[model samples]
Target: MTDTTAAPRLSVRTLVLMAVPALLIGIGSAVVLRALDLVSEQLMHFLWDWLPGQFGADESTPWWIFLILTLTGAAVGAIVWLVPGHGGPDSATTELGGPPPKLGAVPTILLVAILGLAGGVSLGPENPTIAVNSALAVAVFGRLSTKIPPALLVMLAVSGTIGALFGTPVAAALIFTGTVGALALPGSLWDKLFLPLAAAGAGAVTMLLLGGESISFTLEPMGAIQPIYLLQGFLIAAVSAILGIVAAFLFPYLHKAFHALRNPIIFTTIGGMILGVLGIIGGPITLFKGLEQTAELLEHPEDYSASQLALFTGVKIVALLIAASAGFRGGRIFPAVFVGTAFGLLAFALFPGIPISLAVACGVMGITLAATKDGWIGIFVGIALCGDITVLPLLCLIILPVWLIVTKAPELTVHPPEKAPAAAPAKA
Candidate 1:
């Protein structure tokens, strides 16, 4: 009369088995999303540049341009009006926090993100890419309807998403896993250990075929920082943080103003005209949208005099704020990075005697505000952007003080609070 059916602890081999799917998801997602990114880039290049030239337009249309705007408007309007969950499944409830809704929404998010990017909105494709990938994974897994834990599903989805977006399974695994863990999701300690390793390896293998660099940026330290140089770096971080806070505050209001316009096509049309005028006044620094400007700022920091750099930085902040507000459909991460870099470059010129290393550090360190309220994201960015991993500690030291000063104001609340069954999550 004895029945012994106790729960079995996961063996090392068993844990590894769970990780296998995550690894596959990561690799598969990476390959697919990279292709998507390329496709988006080509389409954007054609629409924003080639098509415009062919049409002989003197200026580029607003990112929302296109007969598609009417289409986008009607489509989005319908989705908003009719789809019960068009807003999307609650991300906060889902554990990943604010991700795309439903497996079916993946295609919709991809289409919207690509169109938005092509329209030259000031956003990055990474977020939308992540959303699409996650949704796809969710759908595929959901169909199986297997008895797998939801926590495992979330981790796998995130792993897949990171691999696809960053092209570095390891970094993606680390960051995404950390993000999930920080959010207090499920999965035992054993699950955490093997999952990332497997996912990262898969991601790495995928990127090897994709041909883009696995890491986004690296850092190299100058070594043995003296006091004054340190102080200068601190100052640069401080100023950039102040600027970031100001940007955060302005973004919400601008977005509201654009939405208030009611009609999408006319609103977008007016938005384009307004941006064009700003482009004229601000010069090419405002053109090609944010990415081009970020590149120019990094390469030719000296080309911009101190005054010009300051003016350009301020203009970009406003430009991004307005672009996002006008329903341009881009992400803000790039603009923030670009603006931070510009500010750092300008600070070097203005302060004089500051090391270029310091400028680089400050530029990245300052923009961390946009990464998350936690502030450490900016520090990581400061070092990560350097293209040398060794510089992280130094970057962190300098960013700490600046983060403190800038955050002294009422903190900019960017993401909605974590909640279950919230409204629709954005594509990104």
Candidate 2:
């Protein structure tokens, strides 16, 4: 039987017509994303700023961080235990751009995402936003037109959400290439991507209009490529990639360890306590998703000694591992970027003569590549964070060897074992 939900060879006319809904989806994605960010930002201020100040203690103090994170975890666990949809699929177990999530789970997922973000969990907003947008898009579009397959709608929603997240349609194209490339569609690659691209472009533009900020920094551009610097970039990227691979390899085991606690509330609460210790050890710099912290690290590299930078890198990696594993709902990319940034900055602080921007960009590229397992995004974000187009050619060449090692590593997601089937009835 022909499944009505399966994607067919969409005609050019049908594809073009789909753009209208795609555009709407993109706009809606941006709106929801913006709303979530704003709400999270406000709550973050309340928890990390207003409340701490009212109590006359610095928010970054060890005791305060410990209390907040532990409590946040307990609250989130309670939500997962009692809330509708159980906070959606655990972020640790799902791949970005994989299956469409249930629409009913959207609110709880967003709530936990907001808590994690505002509570200083070492994670990002990508997975949750994509999940919610994809869920809503599928539900709305499915009702509007049964002819459009759920996959098509999900692709559009993911493209739109990624575009908004990164503030560029280009990111949507590059990161999505591997996933979309496998479809044996009738059109050329670009033809296959046309509608999604439209949605991405719309989402980017909407985000820009809504005052989205791009990750950027001021650094002297790399001079004409130096042969010596090639080796330098390769070293930085390779080392950072190795760290990412280690975390990826450890993900599933850590997930099992956390789940062995046998209760969502208990495991999450314990995870929060561990994260608090990491925050105290790494200081305030290693908390959150690392976007703002990455900027801060770059703006004043001198403030962090090489040892402190090393601590930041190591702590951030561990924090990310625990946060993802212990049932926290968030993305891994931003924290990975933070780890790369600190490691890169540490290299510069120690050596003093290497091009600082190159070190940072290469470091970011390597880790992002390993973390995402996507070469295009790694290069793009490395360039994005460094804000230097001149580093692009060098990053391109440097990622080759690093990619080889990284390709064999497991993804930074978990695969919990399946349970045995129930016993057959004894009475016959």
Candidate achieving the largest lDDT: 2
Give the per-residue lDDT digits (tens) of candidate 2, residues 1-428: 97787545658787778889889988888888888888898999999989998777677888999988999899889998888888999999888877877888999999999999999999999899989999999899999998777887888898998888888889888876767766545556777787788889888889889987666686666777789999999999999999999999988999999999979999999999999999889888898989899999988888889988989999999999999999999999999999999999988888877788899998898888888889999998888888888888998899999999899898888876665557533521
RMSD of each: 6.0, 4.6
lDDT digits (tens) for residues 266-385 of candidate 1: 555555566555555566555433655665666656678988877777776776666556545445566677777778778778776676656866776776564345455565556555
Instruction: Give the Å shift of residue 310 in candidate 1.
Output: 2.5
Off by over 4 Å in 2: 1-12, 423-428
Please list all clashing residue pairs in model 2, or write none if there are none.
Answer: none
lDDT score for residue 189 of model 1:
45
What does the lDDT come to for candidate 2? Answer: 0.88
Off by over 4 Å in 1: 1-10, 55-96, 173-193, 213-223, 262-272, 281-293, 374-376, 388-390, 405-428
Q: List the candidates' TM-scores in order.
A: 0.77, 0.94
